[model samples]
Target chain A: MSEEIIIAGFGGQGVLSMGKILAYSGIMQDQEVSWMPSYGPEMRGGTANVTVILSDERISSPYLKVYDTAIILNQQSMDKFENTVKPDGILLYDPNGITHHPTRKDIKIYQIEGAKLAAEMDNKKIFNMIVLGAFLKIKPIVKLENVIKGLKKSLSERYHHLIPLNKEAIDTGMKHLKKFNIEKHIIHN
Target chain B: MAELKLMKGNEALAEAAIRAGVDAYFGYPITPQSEVIEYLMAERPEKRTGMVVLQAESEVAAINMVYGAASTGKKVMTSSSSPGISLKQEGISYMAGAELPAVIVNVVRGGPGLGTIQPSQADYFQSVKGGGHGDYKLYVLAPASVQEMSDFVADAFDIAFKYRTPVLILSDGLIGQMMEKVVLRDQVERITDEDLIKTHGSWATTGKTNRNRNIVTSLDLQSEKMEARVHRLQKKYKQMELEDLRYEKIDCDDAEYLIVAYGSSARISQKAVEIARKKGIKVGLLRPLTLFPFPKKQLFELADQVKGILSVELNSGQMVEDVQLSVEHKVPVEHFGRTGGIIHTPEEVLDALEQKIITHGHFRNHKTRESSIL
Candidate 1:
């Protein structure tokens, strides 16, 4: 099964890095993966996003207007991408930033206090890790251990000390995940 | 032998450039194509093979520097997106006029002017019909995937050096953005100054030489000589029609209808062909991977058996003209597509085929519509 995902947030919020981590995890798992960023000017300020496509077979195109999953870090990102989520897709958002809720009942919505959880872990920047953990809980496309390995491999020696805090943030976010899955057609057995 | 690795389009191009024995790379950073420069900058193959990579001030300077490097009989190339490719047209025309061998890659973006950073095939006419002044042709190759993107760079250089002309890789945003598994080629033999028709000498502004002053200038005021020069170019182009034409034909032998498309558009067209066959429509796809030589002969041969032709593209009927030219008055060549950064889906092409059947019967006086286009 192929899973196409979009991760969007403000610049330096690690939205791009989050997508990269997911893609790297897919590659490590031996799945065909592609990561494409917003073409040009869309990368500047308002919102920065990346599309990660993980598939068992060859992927024809990287451009997507409708994605199977979207992880939004801010209200603005949720506002921009909410309409584009495919039917029965998952919408994971940071409850600390987005006050408004999803209007679509068809989409499985997971709202986590990502910023607050990261602050409790003594690192607010680990908010991205919170979102990643939520994705792992909802999709379970890759193993949690694989993601941890990917993160450790990607982190530089200079910042190796932050790995434990980041790991705690992921665990906290996963613990708070409230699955709103309404689709019984999914064959998880 | 190298294993297939999932690589981005630009990264593939960089690996291909090295395998193609590229001696120099001159380019400026642009969207969709920036990864190419980044890859080359990081790889630093120049230290091992005497290669040189320079980030130029602009696309114009880059192409001119390429022109200079090519004149030295070195394998040189530059890559850019639509806007930058437009700026390099002047230098490209000069390189072509002087019969210099150089490879230029344009990772196309939407535009008549600063259109957008998105993927586009709007530059079809510009790349094939000559974007610069005067009459000229760039040997244009369109690859649909990252694997092809990696494979075509070496082929582009080989064709350029063999034909003594500028070769263009007319890649779109899809090819630039996508990632695929590509088997990287090992180190290959390099071409030196002595391998070319003419190298740096008194004519190339190279310090000194003993032979008659070779003139590399494109300005030939003498009409007869200029005419003769053009004829020679025409003859070479004609010869290329014999050796350089390339296309991928799938299930065309017994098919009654043919779809003509290229680049990423053709990839979807391939799936459409499969869909049509399952429905018993007897449809096949003729993908002209090389846009300039166009594989006109294949279209002409299929025209005799096929009922009609459908030309698909990312623009409004640009490549349709080429199919029409090939089919002549033998069959109808209908156009289908959406332009301006929008990609036409496979379902849309299937709809176009059904529409073709609805409007015109098997042949439906195909002669008349054919004449209007050809």
Candidate 2:
């Protein structure tokens, strides 16, 4: 199985790191993975995106045309990648600053109020993890234990204290997301 | 068990050099490849293994530093992007003439001048055809994956020493910036011997311990002596062509059409091949690992079986000429590419194959290797 995902948002929205954590989790689970970020001028003040691919087989073409899942954060990303999602694919987004919502009828759309939830939890950095938690709840490609291991691997030793907080944020995100019940899922993750 | 880390290609190249017991690294920072020096500074390989990592004032200084260090038989290296690499061309020629062993890395970006910082394969001709002013062929390795970016460090050094010639790791911004899971090799012990008499004793000027003093010079006043030196270099390149030519063939057994590409273009073409095969087009991909000792004979042999070949590149069209030369117009060859920093998609590559090779082949003359666009 292979999953090609694109995570897009403004410069400081944890767009790249979310893909990094996902790549690490895939590695921890013995899956082949690649994470390619948009390193052009768009990364400065404009919208930034990273393409993450996790496959049981060796992955090719890190620069993808479309995505199996698009984890969009801001309005710019929602406007950019809303229609680029594969038909019957998943489009997970945070409806914090998004004025225009995704209206694709074929793909599944899920919302995680990451900014609101982060404000509620009193930590703005956990916004990415909350959105990640919502995606994982719908499609549990990686386990929570391995995500903790992935967090330990990605973050330095000083940030180890905050892993539990991120874990709590992820649990809150999974609980906050109303359970997706589409029954016949075409794509597994 | 293997030691693995998820690292960007530039960081992986730096880490692999440190783990390979590289003696010193002297490089100026450049876009799309600054991580090579940045990672070495942050990791402090000096404390770990006494390796010296210095930031040179200029690209010229960095390459000349490599020349000086390599004369003493030290495993030294430098890295930069397209423009910076152009500045080091004179020094690279000197190293080639002196028959030194230094691994130089060119993480290419789009360039006719100080072009975009985005990834590109435009340097294919510049590198393989000898960017420096000389009749020398630099040993070139084009890696498609970040794992190969980590692995090719040791491989380049080994080949450099084995041939007593400089090797070039022909990577682009894509392979340099992309992050992926890389399995690193164990740390190799650094060379402690100052003289290095056992390995580089014949030519290295290590304090001139014995015999006649070792002389390191590319300049020979006598015309015959210079001719002999050139012949020696040419012989070595020929030997490399016979012994170490590296390439990969995918799905070519029953292929009706062939796609030839290298480096990042090869990775994109692999996906295109998969998609085309699913659409019932029997297409295959031939990826050249060593761009200098190109897959001429391999491609020529494959030409007898396939109807047409499409050379895919990130540039406008450079490697296509080599593809034509390799096959000698046995089958129809076409060039399809995207220039500047724009990368081609898989579907676009497949479409180009159908249009340029299949549909257009019947209307055009097969003898013309020079593309019409040029």
- Choose the strongest candidate by TM-score: 2
Question: How do the candidates score on chain B by TM-score?
Answer: 0.93, 0.96
Superposed model 2: Cα runs more than 4 Å off: A178-189, B192-196, B365-374
lDDT of 2 by residue, B251-321 (tens): 99999999999988898999999999998999999999999999999999999999899999999889999
**Residue by residue across A80-145, what tens digits does model 1's lDDT show?**
999878898888877566676667778877766777777777777888988888788788998877
Candidate 1 lDDT tens digits, B231-326:
877787887788998888878989888888888788767767766888888988888878988888788899999888898888877888988888
Which residue pairs show backbone clashes in model 1?
none
DockQ of each: 0.28, 0.75
Comparing to the true complex, what docking class would candidate 2 get?
A: medium
lDDT for model 2, on a 0 to 1 scale? 0.90
